[model samples]
Target: MSFASLLPAAVLFALSFRLAGAISAQTFAPPSKGPLVQTANYTSFSNNTLHNKHVVKGKVFDRIIQVWFENTDFATAISTPAFEQLTKQGLLLTNYNAVTHPSQPNYVSAIGGDFFGLQDDAMFHIPSNISTVVDLLEEKHISWATYQENMPENGYYGISYKAANYGNSSAKPYSYYVRKHNPLMVYDAVSQDPARLRNIRTFNDFANDVVNGTLPQWVFVTPNMVNDGHDTTIDYAASFLEYWLVPLLTDKRVNGDRTLILVTFDENETWEIQNNVFALALGGAVAKHLHGTTDDTLYTHYSSLSTVQANWCLGSLGRQDTNATVSNVFSFVAQKTGYKNVHVPANQAPQFNLSDVAPGPLNSDAYIPFAAPNLKARGAGGGPVFLRPGLNKTLTVEKLPPPVDLYSLKKAVPWQMSPRTTSGKNIIPCADSDCK
Candidate 1:
């Protein structure tokens, strides 16, 4: 549906008012102190931890901050008053899309380049051998971190955390922090590392990081389930952004110094339709002339990885990041970096609504073992491709044989035990419940 058709007259009036006088940074107070706050008697791990902060200059933007919301269709989000208002402050990406359904896979693909056939929101532990954008950033000595709101502790491994005395007493405790929404925690390479885990901090850590001028180069921020709209509405998510992000946009510590902030959703709400989610680029990196402009370039979750790779001239994971059909660098970044993006007609674009459609090592029913990346494939970054050790160099994902029917044979896949098996049941402790 057209944005104009979806936008109500009342919302349009509000948008006009918002554009006339944009919300001020002083309109809302700073984020509240959470469980990670440090007091004279109590010290949190995040407070004592020293986060890595190397300022690696990029071709377009020095820093990138990704703030992900929950499921909301493009039209639905754009029709909202706050979203429409916010669009006037930055460039709107009209053709941005999510890779697959549910949410975890999209989050995983955002950093790892490929989801490895993840189809559910179940707790998964990707093997350490698989390299992510984290590896690429670290290879160039570029610091990165993920700030998850309502996460009880730093580098927390619990499946979920519920706030005490939340909501009605008759109902179960409100699960504010969930593992599925956290992308870095799903990968064993990041979660198992003591240093990397410490970097996976809470919202309180975010406030502290900003206060101390210790924010990293790359940041992934996930609000709680309610604030992200997973358990609430888009209106609630917008309210949270108004309360939190609107103030931070003008803050020198968070959004200044050529920082590129992307406000986007994980996926669309309607599964039958294309996974087109509303996304916008804001911050000091956005040129003054580009404000309130719209870029209709087709982009996917993989584009997040590709854009970062192109901006920093980093090596490619050689997965979907090299796939021209799906991965396209942000137009502004591509223009500056001299990266050519493929423009597929909207009709020819891949339908990303289906889940478990692709076969990979992670899918037990139609399973194919892990294969080496296409070393010859060049990406927007125009750098050498990163190859994980122990991968079969002789086999490429394209050249791999037909998937084996492991489920029929009652065989378990390598890496970790299959989630269907009893052994894998204990992989995620206190899953979908209040651990503490």
Candidate 2:
């Protein structure tokens, strides 16, 4: 059915949805729900007509920055004073959601457009032949880069940094540059390609680029564990952004009317939380009047790709992104309005990063990062269990034993497969170790 046909119901429903607004940042409610502290309030906009309007033209934003944070639910994040204060400076998507649980698959889905049944944080490779948003950006001649904090070196391809200071790996104060949160590293094309490999740099590079006005057209930034609120609280991540990133948004070289910045988390606190995360859309590209407004559209991680694809008309990754919804708040941009269809090819399923690549240059250990968790998709087994103790019940990835007698939580079972192979078939951690 056409979106036009669905408008009346959606608008009426939006009227009853909670609306987020820019009130006095100094006065706010106490935190609730998760690790740190989070959006509801959608229909309270002073300008009620905005609900009826789909697109509004304004400045075009060619430069975009995406900052991804760790697991934090909306309720908890909203309680965070800084995150709440920051919401006033831009459009808040109250109903936004992450694509999946655990950090790896969501990050993968953000760039690759599909999850491919990823259930753990293991190191894995995507084939060089398969394309990502990186390919689309490059195809359109748009420059892009991925900057991560605390990485050992530029293009360093490891699952995580050795503890920031040895014992700092403790869950509450977790701190490190984990590869699982950095999506670009898993792309075989970027990792194996020399020139593209260098594009994945540390946050220091991002700092320098911002100072030098050398930021790329599309930039992906990830903070360390503590800074992203993974092993810490939302207050930690919010303070990091408030102090480090907020200033950059004012510098014309780093941000302005022609640029867009998104501060979003990878997933939610628990599966019972339904994968909701706090999301903010701000920048020169965002209409000024939209600063304190809220968009209630139910967007997911794929919307990240969809927004960029729509903004640049970059086509699609031939996956769910081809059909994923774009950020409706930015409907004002002319480029976003001009195109709708996302180009797709028939063979769009994820081709493992190790597909067809020789082990000589690429090994299973480095290419495939996480071990199978045998997590059940259903309540008894495979499905997510959000009602757990501690702050990061799901995102704190586990380390399974190696192939030589790998672990079986319930009973002994054997499963193995090469990560960097074209066939890419292996032992998936089924509920009963049922690989079939």
- Top-TM-score candidate index: 1
Candidate 1 worst ten-residue window by lDDT: 34-43
Report the Cα lDDT for residue 286, model 1: 95
Question: TM-score of every model?
Answer: 0.86, 0.64
Q: After superposition, how far is residue 244 of candidate 2 from its true place, in Å?
A: 1.4
Superposition TM-score, candidate 1 onto the true structure: 0.86
Best candidate (score: lDDT): 1
lDDT per residue for candidate 2 within 250-303, as digits (tens), equals 678677667888889888765543566788888877777888777666566777
| Clash counts for all predictions | 0, 35
Candidate 2 at residue 404, lDDT? 26
Per-residue lDDT of candidate 1, residues 1-436 (tens digit): 4355656686566545644554322222223533224321112334543455558899999999999999888877897779989988899999999999778889999988898876666567887778889989988999899988778889888777766423343555567788888999988889999978888987777767876778899999998877787766777778888877888888887888599999999998778789999999999999989988899899998998999999999999888999998999999999999989999898899999887567887766678877787789888888888876666788877788898866577664564322442112223343323431
